[model samples]
Target: MKTTFVSLALFLAVVAQMVASMAVITNPVSSTKGKGGKKLSVVWNDDGKSPKISDWGGVNVFLAVGSQNVQYKLQQLGSNLPVTQTKGSWKVDPSIGANSKSYFIRMEGTKLGSDGNPPMAFSARFELSNMSGQFNSTVQNAANGKEGAAPSSSTTGSSGSSSTSSASSSSTSSTGLSGAASSSKSSSASSSSSTTSGVAPIYLNSALVTVGAIAAGVAAFV
Candidate 1:
């Protein structure tokens, strides 16, 4: 009985440790932060455990709005990256503002891990308040997806959620127009039915009565 209890305890401890392990972000901790237009290192843990991320098929890194929630979406800073390399380079665009304490960095893996899901890592909140200079189109395009990231086509052209809003408006207008047209057609059909089925019979009866009156006058004269 004692041996069985010890074995069960060991098994439970092993499972808990595996559940706790995940890709770790070393930088952009409260101490490290982003500087617009200036190159920075994006680092992750390579603890040499089973299912090391370094062996994954590919990885991607992107910025997020909040530490917990998704925001602006922007685009991927890196794409189809080699997980074997636990580090990559990224430069924030000056045009894209980030000064708050709510932003985050995330690394996404293409291969599954011990948990049967792709590996992912998230950085604590970091600041990019002091941008180095004016906007850099080349770097911005890469991250924002114009060049290829295309994180979300919606994210690509973030301006004017107007495009999305317009699409919705047009759909509503189409529905309204179709309903009006159907109603007009229905009204026209009802009017035509009334004329053909109700008024025509009354006119025909009047004509027959006039013919009988004319015949009676002719016979009386004879």
Candidate 2:
């Protein structure tokens, strides 16, 4: 009986360890930049043992901004970053102003393995930023296909939230515009069904966040 109990305990411990090791958190890389930049941070526990992040040792982490081919290899934590690091600067041409339609940012990351090679695995469509320098992007409700129903926060932009207020206003305007433009309206039944079916859909990142006031001013010329 004693042997059996010890074995069970060990098994449980192993399972718990695995779960903890597999844990992952992809958050917005924080800095003094007043938002609106394509820069973000990626931190993870590459090892199964959870040590205070300061002791995580040197691990090569690769960050890919959205769909762009540009990959900035980050070797250290926030402190290790250059003192004059270009904070909150988007990958696009700095010449594009806040009004320019091409401003945007996306989230992507990879983890290094014990083999000391490039990323062995990668993250999925985690977060998207409008790069409006105001963080306002429409998020489709995950439960339905509808846009702009989820509540968000300015602080949560790094945690997979678009500018919530902006999203709401934009959603309302989009719905109104679509309704007005529909000359051959469908029957109420069909319309209701479609609306219901499109309730909460996965939001997409199509907008861009302009850099801080300085870069934004420059974007106007680019």
Candidate 3:
């Protein structure tokens, strides 16, 4: 009798815990400051007592703005985030608002809502600043599931070329001397230092074509 009552109470408490954590954002707890180029650990937690997180499949993380009347989405930090794993790395974009405080992180589950969209959970509103150590917006015409693009990278290259990655590149150029028979003089010096390595053509003094022809004619007469 008493044991049955106690068991029921414990089961009810467990259900309540899971209900509260359906899609709870744990990081950026209303005081987080984010700046451009700064990396952020976007973390959340969820437990499914009945339907379960696995039933939903995955969650999407988005940066959003909330007002008394409406919610506006900014950029999606990640797509298909695991429900139970619930951890993602995001970089604060420089294009966002300056010293703004109306931002929150939105965690959306794959489960459809009454409005034909995934049900969303939001973190407490936080701040974003252009300066470092700051605790880091419009309604889109359409909900875009696309993930944000990563920052572009640039690497210094030879001859004023900029490459994004470390890949080997080489160029060879050969300036051959045409009409060697008509050339009068040849320079012994090689080409100046070039950005790319190449084989240089060697030129000798012009051949005596006329003299050879005369000698051949005399030999024929003899």
lDDT of the structure predicted as candidate 1: 0.36
Q: Write the per-residue lDDT of candidate 3 for residues 92-133, one digit (tens) a residue.
A: 654432345655665656665322334444565566776221
Question: Where is model 3 poorest over a 10-residue stretch in terms of lDDT?
Answer: 154-163
> For residues 1-222, could you state the per-residue lDDT of candidate 2 as single tens digits?
011111333333433332333212223222222122354444332333342222223322222121111111111123232212223322321111122222122221222222221111122222333322111222212211132121111110111111111212211112221101101222345331111110111122212111121121111000
Largest TM-score belongs to which candidate?
A: 3
Winner on lDDT between 1 and 2 is 1
Ranking by TM-score: 3, 1, 2
- The lDDT ranking, best first, is 3, 1, 2
After superposition on all C-alphas, the RMSD of every candidate to the true structure, in Å, is 34.7, 17.3, 34.2
Look at candidate 1 and give me any clashing residue pairs: 145-150
The model with the greater TM-score, 2 or 3, is 3
CA lDDT of each candidate? 0.36, 0.21, 0.36
**Candidate 2 global CA lDDT score:** 0.21
